[model samples]
Target: DQQVKQNSPSLSVQEGRISILNCDYTNSMFDYFLWYKKYPAEGPTFLISISSIKDKNEDGRFTVFLNKSAKHLSLHIVPSQPGDSAVYFCAALARGYTGNQFYFGTGTSLTVIP
Candidate 1:
């Protein structure tokens, strides 16, 4: 059904802790996965991404792990800071579609307590 789902709508963590966000997808054709972070009124910015062929991808403070066989993925942030408070969206791109059609989960708002 091309639905990407974020099970948790929000998450709260204290500063300097690790924050984990989870996502699931029903579509098996999705070969590309991405995580986007957004502030209050701004648009989402790409954080990390992993191709279906790979199991994990990492940036400076963020890491994304994908389990294609299980149709699951997760984003992890280490040493969460107060600035990390924002909405995170999990996105998936279906293979074989020429146009830019990316499916996004509702989103998970992360609050980093100071």
Candidate 2:
């Protein structure tokens, strides 16, 4: 079962436009949500994170929103740039004493057309 799912395998947008990526989870026990960006052959880098206690978090060009009732979350990037083209992975921290173990979605590749 896919506890975390990024429905869109890929997304394309024009530069300077807004890009929205969606994710869904089936595990209600997950308490921490994170978004990571990765380029080919490199490890993912943390982009933003939201704790279950909070509904939203933002950093510069990126913002993440969580809706606990729907078990859904989304990442929004404003003024999408060519540099933002990469795979975005939505991850959740497993419940119990797992020491911050993360379950990742397959990932969504974003392409910005300049």
Candidate 3:
């Protein structure tokens, strides 16, 4: 059972357009949000992240927004480039008594057309 779900399997956008990736979670106990980007044959790399206490976080060209009431989060990449084309995964981190657990979405493949 996936606590996190990515509704869109794929998304395409122009090079100069903004790329918005979305994710939803069923668990309200999660305290952290993380976004990762993966290229073919490579492990997923951390793209950006935000704490549950904050609604928005921005880093360079990437921004992450979290809506606690809706249990939704989104990653925005402004002026998306061809190099930014990759599979994106959003993960929720839950701190439990046993250990920290991470729930990951299925992933959304993003293609930036140049």
Residue lDDT tens for model 2, 6-103: 99999999999999999999999999999999999999999999999999999999999999999999999999999999999999998666476789
TM-score of 2: 0.96
Better structure of 1 and 2 per TM-score:
2
**Which structure among the candidates has the greatest TM-score?**
3
Instruction: Write the residue-wise lDDT of candidate 1 on 1-50 in tens digits.
Output: 53999989999999999999999999888889999999987999988899
Instruction: Tell me how far the alpha carbon of residue 58 in candidate 3 is from the true structure, in angstroms, after superposition.
Output: 0.2
RMSD of each: 1.2, 0.9, 0.5
Sorted on TM-score, best first, the list reads 3, 2, 1
- Across 8-93, the per-residue lDDT of candidate 3 in tens digits comes to 99999999999999999999999999999999999999999999999999999999999999999999999899999999999999
Which runs in model 1 stand beyond 4 Å of their true positions? none
> On a 0 to 1 TM-score scale, where does candidate 3 land against the true structure?
0.98
Worst 10 residues of 1 by lDDT: 93-102
